[model samples]
Target: MKDMIPVDRKMSTMQDSKISARGVQVYYGETHAIKDVSVEIADNTVTAFIGPSGCGKSTFLRCINRMNDTIDTARVMGDILIDGEDIYDPRVDPVQLRAKVGMVFQKPNPFPKSIYDNVAYGPKIHGLARNKADLDEIVEKSLRKAALWEEAKDRLDKPGTGLSGGQQQRLCIARAIATAPEVLLMDEPCSALDPIATAQVEELIDELRQSYSVVIVTHSMQQAARVSQKTAFFHLGNLVEYDDTDKIFTNPQDPRTESYISGRIG
Candidate 1:
């Protein structure tokens, strides 16, 4: 059985965080999607957010990169700091912010352009490379980091959409990393992939944490256990519990977390 403990008690037990959220909330028109949630994402580690359908896990993830701003009715409040700087400040340009904090969605959305073009897009837009050779170097480096270079090195001119679902996802990851983002947000990245593809992506995610902070919203408890160093359990717009992944899976501190993880309730 899981213990019943206060949320603060659980958080106090973790190490320092790289990105911190305090009293964060989100609303879509009249619907309160997220309510007063606070948590920390450690640097160079993978953190997983798990919950049932409509539980605000994805909503909270979008807040980190300011993706919610694209929604007409979406509204976010409270503090979300990356490296101790409040991202919600009026001075923050979401365009520039998104460059520093990249996101990958549930589907493997690759552009219609060639694979090389896909990886070079961010660097081209951000002016990270000066000449053609520099841009090619950046693309090659990004693909190598994403582990897609061997498969894609010869097919650089092939359309990104021509790849398999799993390959496309990896390509998207390469595209995100091409910008050298400090943080990476993934929302159900494997939900659309097959078992083998899922495994490959999961392995890649683990490798990614050595250089970038990763936050993932996943529906599979086993996936979370396999990938994340930390886990946050959300229920009904509230963050019920957050702790080491091992503890959350083996011995959750909240009844709600226990119930959800134990298949008793969502």
Candidate 2:
């Protein structure tokens, strides 16, 4: 496995990180998914992970929130620190950790419950609000942040599954943000949407970066270029290069990154 890159060496000194990973690796049974990958995620910035299928971009993203822990056969090694605290420590609760680091999947998996219920689920579980009024406020704030409040406000009682694809995805985003997480993880969030829907989600992602650190895994280089400040390119379970999005797209130091960007190979 390749040596992990030091976070301070890779990121700008001016940037303050929300999460710092060091010597991270992940495996599913005997299959190695991520190989000694380390990088810093700056607060209030969007970091994009781009690579071909099976390159472990999504795998690394899932590692941040301990999502891989749900898989019985999965094993993770090394330290992942959130606010300089290691998340993998036995004392750390995965459930609580997930509340601080929310995730949205590639597909919009809205609950069968009402639109209001969908957004309220996270806060309800995390005990973020006590009274009904407080819960309502939390839900509304979350929906507004996700840019879905105006569209869904009147239909709060309606089933989340009844909404349009893009609306449903936004509802999911609202749900993730309801807990007021410090970081948000998105795994190919716009993959299933049409061009217009994709654009809307992309815009929402940009708006979200104002308050939370975001790490997105996308197969589309164009989308990565458009939404992310920092970009990491993975190839064959290796993080081949990580740098500013402009540099990664325009003048990457690694031949592998250059070849993938130029369409020679992925």
Candidate 3:
């Protein structure tokens, strides 16, 4: 395992949480997915959600951006606040909320459009750019942030699908950041990548914490230790424990968390 570097050392000052969830609950038709979960995610920090395969980590993650609204049978009940404003309010627009909170899925799902267009899509839809020149700059900057500009710059007009798996994943990340989102949610982003590709994405995730509040749901305990400053361990639809990465991994308070971390139970 690589030595984990502290992200706080790279920042001049600590920022307050960008997201706060209180009594969050989720249901999929008759199944209760998340049970009264609450957590506060700080700005410019990386928070990892970890647990067994069927735990509610992913379900609760979708609540942060209101992504569950797309499912007819999915229901969310809670007060999720971004910047102190309730995102679950009836007046809040899910489309606009998604724009503010970007997501990168488990698999690399880049659009069939050109590399430039894939990154430009979000900015265009959100009106982040005023004209062609502005859009070009946003696209370039986004790709650069995702650490794909050097490889993708010459292939701006090429199909996004033509890129390598890692490149395509980075492109998807570029697409997400293009909207200038304040918070970024990653659902097992490294799950589909090779070790080399996963390392690159992990590095990018650390770098991203300098600007955005990053929340990641990953099954790899090593990954959770490597990428996150804070860690939340979920079990059977319940948030069993949440604390500093070092404490959670080294000195967990909950017996369930200790069992999961020690590989005794999951």
Candidate 4:
């Protein structure tokens, strides 16, 4: 069973939300990919989206960082606000928005570059550093945050892709953190990793929430229950339920949520 937080603490978290969505709908060509879905994600917290395949959990996850904009036929409507600023506003630059909201994909797709360069790439393009020393410090700090500095320190000049699956994932995580993002979006970040690697990444996720709002899409109910404070269940493009992870797991309000959590559906 999952542990529950105090109701007062939950209320405080609600007031401290960092990302707010309202009436959000998404489409790819004529097919609707996401129904009207809305939720508030609190800063310094871990939120997980869980559901069966093709349920639009991943689709909704991408909306937070606007990754769907890269798809030619994709269309997103409704407001997605980060810190009260609407991201879809004409004034917002998608490129800059991406930097503030970094993403880590399921596969450990590190740049074909060296480990150090992989972490340094973001700070370089974003000009987060002024000189070589600044870039070096950023790289070290990011790698440390990802819990990979000790293992990867000596091999900084080696190719990132040459690392083990878990190491590569951690490197990707370090790369994301190097940008100093306010929110971190992870899409099945541990799906490609082994048990040990998944555990390592899960720990990293917990640590990351201490700094940034983390939103993750995962197929594993155990993973979601283990790492997330808040959980949302999606089914057939609809947000069926969202609540404290404990409530969603132990005593869901919606029948669909209860069904999914009890292994009756999904």
Candidate 5:
């Protein structure tokens, strides 16, 4: 596999990053969620954010695409740059930014629309396809990328919600990638799947790293070790450690990380 290379070496070799966060912090009303966290995410790599519940892992993930801005009580302070451009700049439209940075949630939240329409939603809204043929081609390509085209081909008009849990998640993945995003964010994507389906999604995640930067928030340490090149551990809203996944799991430098990994404390 392409990921066979040493992760530390891979990180050192790729000088360009898809996203950079500097002193990023998020607040929900009186609660300070993320605190002074900063990291660089390389392109075409999978980075996992692992932590116990409510440790700000998911909150920080949302900041990448400015998904946190939707909450009236949420306030983000700090610099988040995508390809050297500050995404929180006044001129950058959150809607347009989301197209470039696609996200899949913990659940398979496919639209109430048909399978075809679900995948085509982003492309249609972004005007990515010029006509019906173009739209069809894009929809096919996205479904194929998500590894769901063959199963759904005969039932394109069926409701996306009608698919099995795993299929629905893949459909959501298709919908996210239809716009051809530069970065893909996933929050506990495999949490709802069975072992077989989880394996499928994990394989798909590895394949996706070839085309886009993938950042995932997962509670499972094993999942982070399996699917991510880099892993960041968060504790009490602070970024405790960030390094190659192997290093983070095998030789974590911080005591907090070690404790968390050793099952001493969450």
Candidate 6:
């Protein structure tokens, strides 16, 4: 369905698509954390995933870059394709896959290195730069994209951990984009920021959609409405509703969706 050609064992060719999840399920040891979920994420758009705590929104987000694979007992069953390639394929390297599918977490985490080095880390490892000049350009471009270049340019050698929380988070975003990813997965990026910082990050998120497919998991409904063009509502591990931001917020077809939007359920 939807420009996809069926294949065997959780494999599919989703050409011209940014991200596609089919019959996705997740398990932690013996507990089933996510039920069968399916959705398609478009390129150059921001898709927000909203739900109550532990509703599997973040869990599903982690599946995109295989972050859950770090857990000893976390098992994922499904096909997650980006640009027609199956990320779970044996031939695919998770490190490289992560480069293509960058992520920013709930809390800002910058390496304990200079601001310049923090932004240049990914490019250095991925060989995106030819030399010091190239790395410097990449760092400057990434920081500008994250909207932190003007503030941090004078302090390039300063430790990234020395910046304010909001600046640190923006630094992390710069690092993520330095590798030139096609999809960006953010897990509640504004949860830890002040209102002003959140507003700035929100603005940056909107701008980022011009270059990459951004998928954000946010607890804030207003943030989702402001940043995303499409929205998906999850409940107790199931994807209850997915539609245009206006439709999902204004006139949801599903009762559960309406309840959540109306403050009846979460």
RMSD in angstroms, candidate 4?
A: 2.4
lDDT of 5 at 135: 99
- After superposition, the stretches of candidate 5 with alpha carbons farther than 4 Å from their true spots are 1-13
Q: Which 10-residue window of candidate 2 scores lowest in summed lDDT?
A: 1-10
Residue-level lDDT tens digits of model 4 in 152-227: 9999999999999999999999999999999999999999999999999999998898888999999999899888
Return the TM-score for candidate 2, rounded to 2 decimals: 0.94
- Model 5, 1-266: lDDT tens digits are 22443454344346588899999989999999999999999988899999889999999999999999999999999999999999999999999999999999999999999999999999999999999999999999999999999999999999999999999999999999999999999999999999899989999998998899999999888788888889999999999999988888888999999999878887
Cα error, candidate 2, residue 3 (Å): 35
Per-residue alpha-carbon lDDT of candidate 1 for residues 1-266, written as tens digits (9 for 90 to 100): 22332223232234468899999999999999999999989988889999998999999999999999999999999999999999999999999999999999999999999999999999999999989999999999899888899999999999999999999999999999999999999999999999999989998998898788999999998888888888999999999999988799888888899889988886
Residue pairs of candidate 1 with colliding backbone atoms = none
Instruction: Please write out the lDDT profile of model 6 over residues 1-266, one tens digit for every residue.
Output: 11121122121222356899999999999988899999999888888999888899999999999999899999999898888899899999999999999999999999999999999999999999998999899999999999999999999999999999999999999999999999999999999999999989999998898888999999988888777878999999999999877678878999998888777887
TM-score of each: 0.94, 0.94, 0.96, 0.95, 0.95, 0.93
Evaluate model 4: give its TM-score. 0.95
Per-residue lDDT, model 6, residue 95, is 92
lDDT of 6 at 22: 92
Candidate 4 at residue 237, lDDT? 95
Q: Which residue pairs in model 3 clash with each other?
A: none
Poorest lDDT segment (10 consecutive residues) of candidate 4: 4-13
- As a whole number from 0 to 100, the lDDT of residue 102 in candidate 5 is 97
What lDDT does model 6 reach? 0.89
